[model samples]
Target: MGLTQRALPDTPVGPDAFVLGRRRLRSGFRRSDTSRFCDDVWRLAPVLHQRQQASLILNFPAIPARFRPAVKVLFYALLNNKPPAGERQLGVVTIHGYFQAFKEFLDWLDPQHHDRFSSLTPVDLCQFQKHLLATVSSAKQRANHRRSVRLLWTWREHLADDHIPVDPDRLEDDWNEDNSRARRRENANPRIPEQVISPLVVWSLRFVDDFADDILAAQDEWLALQKKTRRDSHSGHGARRRLAALMRRYQADRRPLPGGTEGQHGINIRHLAREVDCDRQSLMAPASWGLIEQAREDVGVDDSTYLRTEIRGLLDGEPWLKRISYDEDLVVLVRILTAAAYTLIAYLSGMRDSEVKHIRRGCLTTDADRTGKITRRKIISMAFKGEGTPLGVEATWVVGRPVARAVEVLDRLQPKRQRWLFAVPPSSHSHKAPRTTEAKTTKATNNDLNLMVTWINDYCRQHGRTDHIPDVSRRPWRLSTAQFRRTLAWFIGRRPGGSIAGAIQYRHLSIQMFEGYAGTSKSGFRAEAQQEALLARGEGLSLMVDRHEHERLRGPSADEARVRLDKFGDRVRFLGKTPDDNQMKKLMERNDPRIYPGRFVTCTDNPNRRLCRLPGEKDMNPDPGQCKPLTCRNVALTDSNAQAWLQRLAELDARLQASDALAPRVRVRLEEDRAEIQAFLTRAGVLEPADAST
Candidate 1:
């Protein structure tokens, strides 16, 4: 394969000669813009938007004048060719960040060190590792710096003058690359706290389901009013009649006119000027002032100051907000509405920021049975993460009705001709100014999400409601788009039988995510969910072992439970410190397969005697739902399990004594059930023969 492969020549190719990292260059990308390309400003055909282009444009001139050739060659190879050792090709985004690590390496190296890589020695490499420690805050980041250095060795054949002399792979002592990988198995972003996500999602749903229609209606009213104002801006002659009509409409709606800074709900001459067909100067003059003040008084402006729109939003089964007006409030609501859609889609669907943004008009599809009832709802978006293609491959997310509803709301609220669901929202009520066609960038989306939280808190405070989005520590939880998907994975993984918000089942979510929803996974969710389950199991087992809860267990397999639990406890015991993720991972992966705990019993799993297994099932795990504790040889019970058995006998005793007489057959079955539990407990020594008289 190496002999047949073609190599890039030392002389640089034209900027237009098919950019390598992306599967294909963008159709609209001009081939003639050779200046930026020659400057090594690498561009990829963006999957969603051109947001990453700024990062891809490298400044080769910044490097020390001598070593530029080697660095350029290394980058070109990374960009255009399949990486050696069967490594996957780097994506455009990956290459963008990859260069940053190298930049740090070069900055520290080229200052006082050798001009070429071959001149670099072991001592110099050790010092570079030390430099990384002093400069990078994270151990994981320091390891990535060394990875870039290692790449210099990996591509040594191509870097004729500058190949790294020392092998980075051998420098395990200084860098500790293995430790970093194990420690950083999970994501770095903090999960959205329960208090934060609960109310945040509740309010977001409220905005989408309950408040969206009102906000959209108010937007239409405001836009129509603006257009009418523009047309009447020249009709100063009929200003009085127009003013009278406005006053009557305001009185009927019981809303005061847009207030001036002068007094509470008092009319502003400037507002009247825009409302009717006159200039501010004319409206401020004696004649217009006479009409405006009389209109204000006729509308009962002195009784209150709040000018609410006709459409009301709910709070505590009533309207949530005090008012919705047709001005900046409407614009702000649009922003909140977009944030709501984002929260729903991102949290529930597990789409990345890029995929979420790339969700355009008509992306939602559904299948219905013959009765016209919808069966499954799916969202069609592009996954850019693994795709080498310019425009990403089409990926589908089997989302719930909430996600479907949110998409509908987004389509309704989106500005005219805005293709993306999260495209930059209109800034003003008029929406006349043209904005960029890109979706809100990650930073912008993050800001909007936190703002959504802030908006909810303030709304709650004003309404005397206690169910606000709460603070995490002393302050509000800082939210970001990156946190949502990761948090949902953790949520789905741990609470398999429970519901997340109110409607969707966590177990169903796990299944959907494992099957159709691996946005990063091909199935990252399946793996993520399994990791969470293991973590939960580890936590439970740690508690049991630490407290010596296993010592009191009683059943057929009690001896087996004790021996297995002891081995696990001894192996995983840290030096009086909490085990971190790496140690926990090691323990979970290597823990004995025999001991599987449940609410009523622990299965010291002997698969041959397992009652829960189906006819041909050979899975290592025994099904807990189908557990037969009294008869299965694998069953072992903790001290708490006896209390449950005692409670069940008492309930059975009461049912037999019921005056509404049970049939003879029902009495016989109930008595037989009590007798069997009594026999099991008697053998396990958790019950006295005298106490088993129920």
Candidate 2:
């Protein structure tokens, strides 16, 4: 017997069975060629299936019949063909956008031109471009529309050889002499600033390490209840009474009852069964099936308050509330633990959203040396980016202990049969059965993370915690997956002084160590880090120039310093606030006037005139770390740097005066160090003779 012809049971066993039957019935129905084309397009690209269907339904019918086949062909080409190197396949969003543009173009054209394949001309295309520019408010959107029309013209020409020759590229050249207005705008993603990231990092580490066990236990209990409910609903005699008690309590608390029209009128029976780990059939039985009123009266406490109190107690380290049902506490616990795992892995590993979502069960592995001491902990997953060679190419990331622990916790929370680490199992109420797993897609993952942030903040408020994750500006920090990588790059690239972890200073780390995370994509962390580094250099120079203008810095290099500072002031005046990072970057690109920070002096080194060069003569880039300030004419010591030296001398002097038990050699060395700093200060003309006498 054919699968579709096979009779569905008189009463479906569950939601999953009913859904399967409905899908089979739908498939059995004959579909039109256009409908088949649309279905095939969606099947070929599952990610964009829904959007593709909407676009086809809305726009395809409006397109003239003669042009409909051409549109389908274009859609097929885009979906089936491999994109150019470093470019990805056009997503559903882009496809929808293109279709919208095509629809608008069709609407604007004369009725006669719709079916006339060769009637369109360059003049028509040029007019369309002008119309788009005048009508579209966003320059980016205007560009997109123009590009879409151009692509359609190209595809149309390919389909019909006699189609009119129109160079879509030339339309812009003749339209406007001033192209600046139409130029693509810079849309660089900003890094999460240090102030916000520091606290988040600390909290994430603590959550993963300290609270992991509680989260895992909650997950285990939730899963167990789900299993028990499914079992009880089928055969347990008292299932109907328990479900009734739940439904009545839910209603009295002013919570909507389950399973009604629009799903908002009351609680859904399927949803209630899923929540309690029971089958929907068990809940469908009449009120007369058991002593429901008696059960409802017996359970008098408000469900919400009881659940909240029990959760709080569990979070506070009180033993798990044996009195409270596990089903009641499941949702909140699952949300909190999932959020915790996501925060730690995303922030710490610096993986892209696509890459992070690819993390699967058994991804985390340990490597040890001969003595059995673990040397490296790494995550093995597929690299979504730069995977043009072949699909599903494997990649690995070396993760710290905290990230490893978080992955472990996630793995434990997930069902043993599930492959993906971040798979969100379907709820029992869903048409799909429980443990029917799907990997969390990039879009869903991002939305979940944002929701998690809101949930965490609300949870903190309820728990009386003041440390909330703050907004970057006036708007709440809409955490993007890209921000984590860029932020980590900035911290590692421009190592501002403070302990990174315990006694380990960020300055001690090498730039090469973080190059993997920074990446080399035009919009990736590497580019952002370079821009940030340039900004830091410009800000440093601005401070130095500000001091020089005030006559604060005095040194042996003072004359040369004035000349350099004057040049910088002129450049700053020419640049005017250096409004964009790119402007500062352009100045740095012309490297002759570059200023790099050093221990005691700022090196304004030009390789042609460098005084700090060693014997070997080659490339001219300055090694600021190896600079000899006393001899190097390129070095300029600002007043702020000199004050630091003076303060250190003063501290050494105080130590010498206070410590009577100091060894003779130690005392002599301390005096020499103090004398050296004083002599440098005197040479710099910063230490006045009257003050030196004291």
Candidate 3:
């Protein structure tokens, strides 16, 4: 094998080419195979050599002892090919560590037990998997061991392909085609979807920047106060007191002077414009962040003003502003805190959802991290962003004034024993008691804006409000969670030249970090968009029907349905599948009673049921003695009554169309109102003339 009678000297080869070529030839030793395999392995060797580790080399033994030495030799040669000293050792350490893990698997496959090339049967492989899963202490460790096995088989094939004298077919069958390999593959890359990162960082940063000057000043004051009080540690009672006082001063400074500013909240637009690097015009320009102030017609405040005001108010007080516990002024403050926290985390430290969730009392500190903080450490201990592994980012942003105020508010609100930094109190439920303790409670992980929307809607309904809950919804107060976070990202990342928005923000977060699972980047986000899109379409349909009800009821004159369908169908189709629309229509039609059950006259002879004799159909409306009984399905108009009602709708629509005396707005309103009413009545199995007074 060492006799090198070579023709092509110009072939790109590594430093260990002779040794590798000979080893490859001995393994299977075919001229073509050795040439291809040696070059391929040699090219990839730089990557593998960088990952050399004794643990990885040991893992190669799982491929059967016969192949182990050859695989190890290949690994060694790959590592040996590296340029003397300045090269990275990570790649070598990783590959070596990966191979060594196989030894443990091979050890478990005692040859004495079965001895068919020490081949463990599929059943035995299943048992091994069960043993690994059952015995390994942690889910991550079990997952890691399974991953090591995958690398082992991959490396073994590298050695068996060429110069080495071995049966490549048999070796591959023993490894790749085995049940353990399949099971190991499944364990190595589980199909768990990646979760969305908590918006806490972006939210927090926005909150801080909103009060740029005051926050910066407060942070400096807090640091001096911390040093003066000799309470540098985050855990002490003195530390807590100094922190609280600092937060109070911070809040006082952030307060908007009564009738002082023109924009919403106390955020000095002049100051914010400077900080965000946008002109005053862009700052107040119509955008998504501003308050959607539909109620106040004369109010000129844009979304940015509304959001800034709301957010600034929320962040003004403590570190943790509880929206549930706060009044209107404080609610604004809380929202600011939330947004600022999220922004800070995303930009300052690349933290994930798990870390956001695990951030609790005493989880943040101003002290620099000398050593990594573990759970037992009194210092700021962060939950692992990758797995459950604890990570420590040095306290840079924590020293900011806005951060201190946010922390102070949150610290006061922190529940005893693992209380979340962003906890929302549990809503009332009949079946379960509310959990008040931090250990017992769970944080609200949905989009904060969506949650706030729900809270607002529910509160309105409970207080007998009508407009706040859109009348068009069958079930009002439905929320769109994806839009809340996605919109924020989109707004921030929006490119100057894009038609709508190009959300290129948070690019610093690797695709691996954002991907819900390994392969599909858009799968989770797409699913969420589809759901919200459907809801929006449904809402639009309701509004359109309401506007054109009377016109629709006028007997489909001149392809009216087709015209409307064509106009709205494309818009609806853009939401997703047109099939869903057909399905929704079918469901609505089924629930609709075809006859006017409520219009029937009571028969004195039969008191139990009412009889209706209207246009060739006999139907029964049974009375269960209650006025509003569920059995009395006598809706005012049915589909059967629709034909008779069509003429009146047409007449009314015509009058509005021809009207010169009526206000143009009123005439348009009437046309839309009639159309919507007709659709509603048609769906409800109710058709009747408009009220005589109207």
* Superior by TM-score: candidate 1 or candidate 2: 1
Measure candidate 3: CA RMSD.
23.9
Clashing residue pairs, candidate 1? 23-388, 313-319, 313-320, 314-318, 314-319, 314-320, 315-318, 315-319, 315-320, 521-524
For model 2, residues 616-666, the per-residue Cα lDDT tens digits are: 653756766566665566656665667677778779988899667898889
Taken over the whole model, the C-alpha lDDT of each candidate is 0.71, 0.56, 0.36
All-Cα superposition RMSD per candidate: 5.3, 10.2, 23.9
Decide which is better by lDDT, 1 or 2.
Answer: 1
**Model 1 lDDT per residue over 1-694, tens place:** 1211222345354443544533454554454542222344454433224431322455666666566656766777777766788466766666666778888788887778577778888888888888777777887678778877888888766676568777876877765555676656557677887767877887888889989887877776655555544344555557766777777777777666676554325555455565665556656556656766776776654322232455676656776555655444767777888899999999888888877887889999989999999988888887766565645678888888888999998888776587876776554533454433356678777878887888888877887879788887798888888888778877875664443466767666656656565543352556666676777677777788899999988889988888888887877685366677556766778774457776667788877888889757866578877899999988888877777877887898889787259888888899899899889888888887786653
Best by TM-score: 1
Q: Which one wins on lDDT?
A: 1
TM-score per model over all chains: 0.83, 0.69, 0.29
Which window of ten consecutive residues has the lowest lDDT sum in model 2? 15-24
- Per-residue error at 96 for model 3, in Å? 9.4
lDDT of 3 by residue, 260-334 (tens): 154555434443343233344444544411421221222332222211222123333533222121113333334
Cα shift from native, residue 151, model 2 (Å): 2.2
